[model samples]
Target: MIKVDNLSFSFPQKELFNNISFTLEEAQHCAFIGTSGSGKSTLIDILMDPERYLFDGKLEMDPDCTIGYVSQFSELDNTKETTVFEYIGEPFIKLQNEIQSICTEMETSTDIEPLLEKYQFALDALDAIGGDDFESNIHKQLNVANLMKRRDSKVADLSGGEFKLIQVMKEMLNRPDILIMDEPDVFLDFENLNALKKLIHSYKGILLVVTHNRYLLNHCFNKIIHLENREIQEFDGRYIEYNFSLLQTKMELQELAVAEQEEMERNDTIINNLRVIATYNSDASRGRALKARVRFQERLEARRIKAPFVEIKQPNISFGVDNEMEDAIVVSVHHYSVGFDELLLDNVNFEIKSTDKVAIIGANGTGKTTLLRDIFKNNHASIEINADVKVAYLSQLQGEMLKDANTILEEFIDAGFKTYDEIGLYLFNYGFEGETLSQKIESLSGGEKNLLQLAKVSASKANVLLLDEPTSHLDTYTQLALEKAIEKFKGAILMVSHDFYSVVNGMDYVLIIDDKTIRKMTLPKFRQMIYDSHFDKDYLETEQKKKSVEMKIELALKNTDFELAKGLVEELEELIKWL
Candidate 1:
C-alpha cells in the first residue's frame, strides 16, 4: 500500500507537479499516462526514494515495505564482469552476506542474546522477501522473457532490447512489495512486448507503470492517472475511457465559457444604453434601471469562467508527397540474402507499389534493421528500383536531422519540403507551440524530432519511404497524428516498427523476418497469428470518425480557412460521446 499527499516537484526552469496526490492499494494496477516530457518518469523516480517526503510532500507506505523499480533509461554496467544469472540474484546475495556476518559474530561474541535476536530477524526477513527461491524465480522469469538460453550470457554482449528485458526480469525476481516500471515496453519488439504484457497482468503486488504504449496501457492497467498543465487527474478506467472523458469535459467547459461570455457582453450593452439615457435626464425610473443593470453586470463578472488551454490545442500535421506522383511499383526484391558473418535472412521477396502500405516486422536481432541497411547500401543484386524514382529513409533516431544548424521551423524551410505555412504546421501537430520556433533543433523532445524528420521527408520529391522504427519514442497522441498522416499520403510506405498497433493500422501488407528466413504475408493473417483482437468494431468505427474529422480539419487549415476549420474541430469534439 502507498499514499501520496500534496506531492510537488520542480525542474530548473519547468514546474512539473503541483500538489499532486494519489494512493495505490495492494494489488491495484494503475498507469501514469502523459505526453513526452510530462514528468511521468520523474514522478516514478521520486517514488523510489525513502526520503521523498523531504520535498514538500508526504509519501507513506506500511513500515518495512520494499519497492522494486525497473527504470526505462537504466543500462547494464558493461565494465563489470557479471552474468545475467549473477545480476538477477544480487539482492539475495546481499541478504545472504548479512545473515552470514551476523551468525559468525554471534559464535564468539559476549553479547550472545542480542546477536541471536539479530540473526533470527535476518532469517525472518529473508523468508519474507522470498530469498529461499530466488534462483528458481530468476530462471522462471528468464523463460518467460525467452532468455533462458542466455542465462549465462555476459551483460556486455547483449543487445539493447535484450538488456532491457533482462533488467526487468531481474527486478521481477526480487519480489518487492510494490513494483514500478517506467516505459518498460520502449524499444521492445512485438514478441518481447507480448511477454512483458503477460508478466504485468500476472504481477500480484501493487503495480504502477509509466508508459505510452496504448496496447499495454489498455490491456494491463485497470486505472489511469493523467498529468497535464501542472495538474493531475484520475480516471476509473483505461486510456480510451480517460481520453473520451477528457475530450468531453473540455468541450462542455468550452461551451459554458462561450455562452457565459456572450451573456456578459449583451448585459454590458444594456447597461451602457441605460447609462446614456440617465445622463440625458435624471428621471427616477431611468436611474433605478441603470442601477439594476450595473448590479447584474457585476454578478455576471463575478461568476464568469475563462477558457482553458484545451481550446488552444490543435492537431495540425503534414507529410508532403510529390504532387505528380504516379501509381506504380516503386521497388521489387527477389531472393535477397543479406549477411556478413552469417546470413540473417534469405529468400525475401516483396513488391512495393507507389501507394502500398507495408510493415516490416520480426523479433529482436532477426535482420529487420539489416534488411533496411542492405537497401540503403544498394549493393545487393537481388533488389531492383524503378527508374527515375526518388527514395528517402528515416532512421531510428533521426539524430542527423535533429542536430542540424536550423531551429525547429527552420529545418523544414531549409529542406524545401514544405511551404512556410506548412513548415510550422507540424510543430502544432506534434504538440509544440509557437515558442518552439526560437528553440534550437536539438532542444526538441524525441517525438518532436520524429515529426520534424517526417516533415523534411514529406517535402522531398521521393515517392517511396523506407522508415525504421519511426514511432520509437512517440507518445500515443503523436502516434495517432502519424497514423492519420500515413493514411493521407499518396506515396508508398515501407517501415520497420516495433509498435504493433501502428503496424496494424498503418500497414496493409506484412513482411516477416526471422532466423535466416523471410516470408511475406498480409496484415490480417499476421494479426490473427498473434491472437490479436484489439481491432474490434466499436474501436474501428470511432477511429474512422476521428480520422475523417481530422482529415477535414487538415484540409481546411491548408486552405487557410480558419472559420471552417474551427467549426469542424468543434464537430470533432462533439463526436467524443461515441468514443
Candidate 2:
C-alpha cells in the first residue's frame, strides 16, 4: 500500500494543498482530478521526486516495490539514439548488464556458485516482473501493441501516439507495483486509445491516472481524489457517482450559505431601521433599541458562513457570422490528390455547402493535416469555391509563423485592429489584459499561443475555416468555449483534429482518410470503424515524415513569423502539387 497522511504544500504565493491524504492499495485504481493549476501535476511530480520537495506529510511505501510513471507531456530521453526494441527491453538490458558483470567477476576468482546465484536471481527477477518465458512474452507484448512491425524504428522519430504506446509497453514489460499515468488521453487517436485501455485493464498492478477526459475517468478509474478548496476530497467509486454526490453536496451547501447570508442581511437592515428611527425621535430611550440592534448585527456577522466559490472562469468566445455571402457551397474539391514523397490520398472529392462542419480524422500521420493544407493551397488552384468564400486557415504552424513577430499590440494593429485599448479589451475577453496585451508574442507558453491563435482565427470575418488541431492544447473549459463559438459561427469549418470528445459531439460529418482514399462517412460510421479492429494491416498504415512542415506552418503563423511561413507554405505548395 502507498499511504499518504497529513500532507500540506505551499508555493510562494498560495497554499496549494492542505492536510491532503490518500492511499493506493493492491488492486485499487484511482485518479487525481482538479481544475487548472490545482497541483494535480505538482502532486504527481512530488510523488516521483520525494527527495526534492519539502512538505509536511507521512508517506508509507514499500521499499522493494517499483513505481513507474507516464508523463502528460514529457518525452522519453532519446539522447542515446535508442531503438524501439532497445527502449522496450530497457529493464532486461539493465539485467543483462548486471549478469555480465557478475560473470566477469567469476573469471577472476573461484566463486562459480556465487556467480550462478547472482545470474539466477537476475533471471528470476525478470520472470517475476513479466512472465516465465522471456522471448515468447516479449514477442506477445510487442505484437499486441503493434510495435513489432516498427521494432527497428528509432524511438526519437516515433509519433506522439506511438511514443506513448511504447512508453506504456515498456512499463508493462516490467510490471511495476504501481503505475501512474498523467493525462494519457492527450495525443491519442481512437485506435491507440483503445489499445491503452486494454493494456490498463489487463495489467495486474495498481493504477492511478490524472486526466481531464471524463470518458477515460469513468471507464478506467474506480476511485476519485478530488483537489478542491485547498483540500483533498476522496470518493470511493467512479466519476459518475461522485459527480452526482458532489452535486448534492453543493446544493446543501448553497442552501445553508444562502440562509446565512439572508439572515445577516435582515439583521443589518434591522439595525439601519433602528438608527434611522432613533435619529428622528431624538429620544434618550431609543439608545437601548439602537444598541440592541447593533449587538444583533454583530452576532450575525460573527457567525457568517464562508461559502466556497464553485465557478471556474471559462473563455468568452464569440464567432460572428459574415452574412455578406450568399448561402451556397463554400468549398468543392474534385479529382484532387495530396501527398509528399508518398501518396496519402487520391482523387478525393468533397463539398462544404453553406455552413457545414466537417471533421477530418484518420490514424496518426495519415494526411489529415496535409488534406487541410491541400484545400488551403487550392485558393490558387482549380478547386472551385463561391466568390464570397473568405477562407481563414488555422494551421498547426501558426505558432511558428508568429514566433518572431512584435508584441501583441503590434500584431493586433498590423491585423487592422485599431486602438491599443480596443485590442486590449478584445484580448481581455479571451483572458488577456493591459500589460499582457503589450507582452511580446513569443513570451507566451505553447498553450497560451494556441489560445491566442484560436482567438485570432475565430475573430476573423471569413465565411469558411480550415483548422488543424486547434483544440489539442486548450483546457477543457476553453475547448467548451470553442465548441460554443463554432456553434455560433455561420461559416463552413473543415478541421483536422484527434480530440475525440470535441469531434464526436461538435462536428456534423467526418472525412475519413485511409488507404489513399477519402470517404465522407457519418460520425457513427467513423466511430465504429476505429472502435473495432476490422481492417487489415495494410489499410491504416502511415509513412511519417522526417519533420512535419505543416505543424511548423501552424506554429509560425501563431508566432507571427510570416517570413518563415511564406517559404514553408511555398514549399508545402510545391511538394503536394503532385497527384
lDDT of each: 0.75, 0.73
Q: Which candidate has the top score in TM-score?
A: 1
Worst 10 residues of 1 by lDDT: 306-315
TM-score for every candidate vs. truth? Answer: 0.76, 0.76
Model 2: lDDT to the true structure:
0.73
lDDT of 2 by residue, 90-166 (tens): 77878878877987888987868878888899878867765445456566766776667878788876777888988
What clash count goes with each model?
A: 1, 29
Q: Which candidate's lDDT is highest?
A: 1
Which whole-number lDDT from 0 to 100 does residue 528 have in model 2?
Answer: 56
Q: Residue 124 in candidate 2 has what lDDT?
A: 85
For model 2 the local lDDT of residue 266 reads: 84
Can you write out model 1's per-residue Cα lDDT over 413-486, one digit (the tens) per residue? 67764565675665565565565566677665555567667766665757778888887667676687788888
- Alpha carbon deviation, residue 431, candidate 1 (Å): 2.8
